[model samples]
Target: MIDLHAHSTRSDGRLTPGALVARAAEAGVTTFALTDHDTIDGLDEARTAANTHDITFIDGVEVSVTWQRRTLHVVGLAFDRGNAALTEGLATLQQVRRDRAKRIAAKIEKLGVADAWSRAQALAAAGQITRPHFARLLIEDGVCRNNNQAFKKHLRPGRDAHVTVEWASLDDAVAWIQGAGGIAVLAHPFGYGFSAAWRRRALAAFAQAGGDALEICTGTTDRQQEITAARDAAQHGLAGSAGSDFHAPEQFWLGLGRLRALPGGLPAVWHDPRFPGADAAN
Candidate 1:
């Protein structure tokens, strides 16, 4: 199986990097990428574990991008993790995420929650603090039942705990990925709740800004959406990529490489020989 997007405790995920790779291997994921949110701290560990488990490990990261004042994710695949430009770009995002987490915790505190920031810190440990950590806090407080409910009730935009933070522009993010010798893919377009026309505009802009691919098969996308995404990506001259976007085992809607085949007749982002095991994955 080919799974180009996944997370680890290096970001908001539940498992550690090594454990994440082991889990994916158990799930029959042959080609995998550790696309941790805004950080590559887990890549080295995940790569080591992938080697041990005889899995194809792709160096990847999920960048947070603000396009038209809305936060979206861009997946950087087969990148040079040591590339200075990519590392520096991700560093800035790391700080932005930390600040956002603190702001969210402050808001939660204002709602009479005690020691919100410290408790969130304890939950995160050395990992990057994210909204999921906050969601766990909400779950613990009995404010919500799960991550989805936490978002719907309080953490999502237009909610009490939501604090908007400026993220990297789409152009800057795509540039950084390209600089790292990576392909930039728009991740899970349908997950953003954009109408068809709006999605087209976003795909057009992404392709115009040098994005190379868009995810067609993903945990959040259905069969019809996959077909539409493939058609849209072809129209925009972008390739089709697929991934599970797996974060945690408890996430009911996500799994390791559980996506269907990429829509036929579309270019694949990993067709290039530079990405190891590309032939086998196809």
Candidate 2:
């Protein structure tokens, strides 16, 4: 199966790019995409690993975007990994993330957690510092039971430690991905929890802004929900895709390379015109 969505340690995922590729091969994935959060830094390692393992790999990135005041994650697949414009945009995002992480660390310190920044820095170890790194450190220090607890108690939206980040606009994000010769996909539509009207508006805006597909089935979403999302994509004349969104080995519920088939009657996003001959390439 083609698992078109995933992450690596270049973002909040537990594994490195090469490690993730090896794991996917072991898990029986014939094709995969390394859609790491907001960056393509992991692509080189993943590509090399895929070459070694003979797994068909797609260059991908999950860009964090803002639309109507909500965070929208758009996954760009089959991109030109060496595109200069895309790399420049990602560099800006990485800087924004660094700033947000620093603020989170500062807030945690005021809550009597000294050395939080140092702790996160150490844990990140030259990797991109993120809220998950802080969460992991919190778990290690017995401050929180797990990453979920840390997010719930300190890092989630509207909490003291929650910092509002300015993500790229949907149009700009889609343009960047398209410029990189990628198919832009709407990642996990249900995760936003939007109203029906809001969802319609979002989908219309995405199509207008040049999005290619919607991830109908992803980890944590049920079959019914997946069907509904698939229908939504079809109604919007978009293509459908699926993935496990795997992050760690222990997340059995989200096994590596496991994916539900896209709903029937929907054309594959690989054939969509929003992408530069993604269908032809595949």
RMSD of each: 1.2, 2.1
Give per-residue CA lDDT, model 1, range 234-278, as digits (tens): 898888899888888887777898889988899788785556666
Residue pairs clashing, model 2: 270-279
Q: Assess the local accuracy of residue 30 in candidate 2 as a C-alpha lDDT between 0 and 100.
A: 71
Q: List TM-scores for all candidates, in order.
A: 0.96, 0.93
Clashes of each: 0, 1
On residues 1-282, what C-alpha lDDT tens digit does candidate 2 reach at each position? 678888888888889899999999999887788988888888889999999998878888899997887899999888787888888999999999989888998988776566888888777664678888888766776778988898899888887778998999999899999898878899888878788788778888998897878888787788898888888888887888777788888787787766677777877775666443356533
* Candidate 2 residue-wise lDDT at 72: 92
Task: Estimate candidate 2's RMSD in Å.
Answer: 2.1
Candidate 2: stretches off by over 4 Å: 271-282
**How good is model 2 by TM-score?**
0.93
Model 1 scores what on Cα lDDT? 0.89
Which segments of model 1 are wrong by more than 4 Å?
none
Please, what is the whole-model Cα lDDT of each candidate in the order they appear? Answer: 0.89, 0.83
